[model samples]
Target: MATNLDLQEQEQIDAVKAFWGQYGNLITWTVTLVLVAFAGWNGWNWWQRDQAAKASVMFDEMDQAVQAADADKAGRVFKDLKDRFGRTVYAQQAGLLAAKVQTDKGQADAAIASLTWVADEASDEDYRSLAHLRLAGLLLDKQDYDGALKQLDAVKSSEFAGLADDRRGDVLAAQGKPAEAVAAWKKGWDALSDKLDYRRIVEAKLTAAGAQPAASGAAQ
Candidate 1:
């Protein structure tokens, strides 16, 4: 009986060896590939974290420059942030800060340039929209009616639709197109929710534009 048990154990060992001989290389290669992929993924995550950490430090410097009311220093720091870390939110925020300082310094053209860059190149859609809106306002202040309208027209957020239309109306009014302004304001009014207090301001604008509001059933 001991001899028979020894023979069976030997046969089991032989079967396992035969299976390994047929598939061992394939299994080893598959495991190697999976491990390499996992290592690469981990390496990429570490690289991204390192990059963001460095970018954030630079952004802090830019913020300090702005807070100190040093327009030139802020501008230089922001330019570096833009060049090095344009994909970072910090870079986009630096642009806004730089633009504000430039505007306060009466550097309208520089402010517009900074804002235009953010509007065109920000990775975040909301940041891009904000840049466009602010730039449009600046252009309107400069009486660049067509340019302002173009900027306002580029806004794509549904939540911004009413405000963009309202700004468009303001620009049109500035250009002596009161009829078109009224029409734009009406569209903005229609797009706004009834519960929004801002809609009353739109109503006032329409009234001032000599466009009578539609009669409310309650008023009737």
Candidate 2:
């Protein structure tokens, strides 16, 4: 009985050895890769958090500059944010804020540069649309009718459809196309949500452009 048990144990040991020999490298590598990937994922998350925190500080500085109405300071801080934390949302926000201050300060070129960066590089589509809208307005102010139209064309977000139409009306009017302007203004007037007070402004624009206002129910 003892000899038989020993033979059975030896057979079991041999089976295990054979299996290990066949799959040892693959199993070892698989486990190593899983552990490495888990560690890398944790490290990546930590890095992102660290980056965001630093970017937040810079954003606050930019905000302060904007509030103070110091266009030069806002532009400088915005440049730093773009250089060091360009991938962060804070950087995108800074660009927009900096553009606003620059525009207010009559630094049209600086505003254009900042808006262009946000329009091109922002990860969020909403921000890109916002940037494009502002850029279109700036281009319109500069009398770059074609460039304004091009910028308006870049804004494809549904949320900005009314704004785009309104901007198009302005561009067309600037190009001496009053008939087209009136049509564009009507579209913008109709596209706006009834809940928005801004729709009244659009209605006024339509009236000014020689387009009769739509019926109240139809406008709503």
Candidate 3:
């Protein structure tokens, strides 16, 4: 009986070895691939965190420049942010901040460049809309009516659609098209939410354009 048990154990060991010999290479390669993919995923997450940490420092410098009203310093820091971490959220925020300082300093061209970059490259839809709206305003100031209209047409966020239409009305009015302006303002007023204070401003503009809104919460 003991001799039979020993032979059975030996046969079981041989079966396991035979099975491994047939599939061992495939199992090894599969495990290797899974480990490499996991390592790569971890590396990618670490790299993004490192980038955000570095970019945040640069963004702070740009913000300080904006608060100081120093266009030159803001421009320098923005250039660095673009060169190093343009895809980061901090870099996009810095672009908006720097553009504000540049616009306030009468550097319209610089502001345009910054806003255009943000409009084109920002991953956030709202940032792109804000950039497009601000760019349209700058073009309107320059009396580039066609360019202003083009920027307004690119606004992507539904949240800003009302503001874009309002700006469009401004552009149309500036082009001596009061009828079109009034139509645009009416569209804007209807798009805005009654709870928003900005909706009252749109309502006012609509009324001033000789197109009084049939419903307005401005009195409320």
Each model's TM-score, in the order given? 0.74, 0.90, 0.86
Ranking by lDDT: 2, 3, 1
Per-residue CA lDDT of model 2 for 33-143, tens digit only, reads 999999999999998899899999989888899889999999999999989989899999999999999999999999999999999999999899999999999999999
* Residue 26 displacement (Å), model 1: 8.9
Candidate 2 global CA lDDT score = 0.91
User: Which window of 10 residues has the lowest lDDT sum in candidate 2?
Assistant: 211-220
Collision count for each candidate, in order: 0, 0, 0
lDDT score, candidate 1, position 75: 86
Ranking by TM-score: 2, 3, 1
Flag clash pairs in model 2.
none
Error of 3 at 163 (Å): 0.6
Better of 2 and 3 by TM-score: 2
RMSD of each: 4.3, 2.1, 2.6
lDDT, candidates in the order shown: 0.87, 0.91, 0.91
lDDT of 3 by residue, 21-116 (tens): 999899999999999999999999999999999999888898789779999999899989988998899888888888999999999999999999
In model 2, the number of clashes is 0
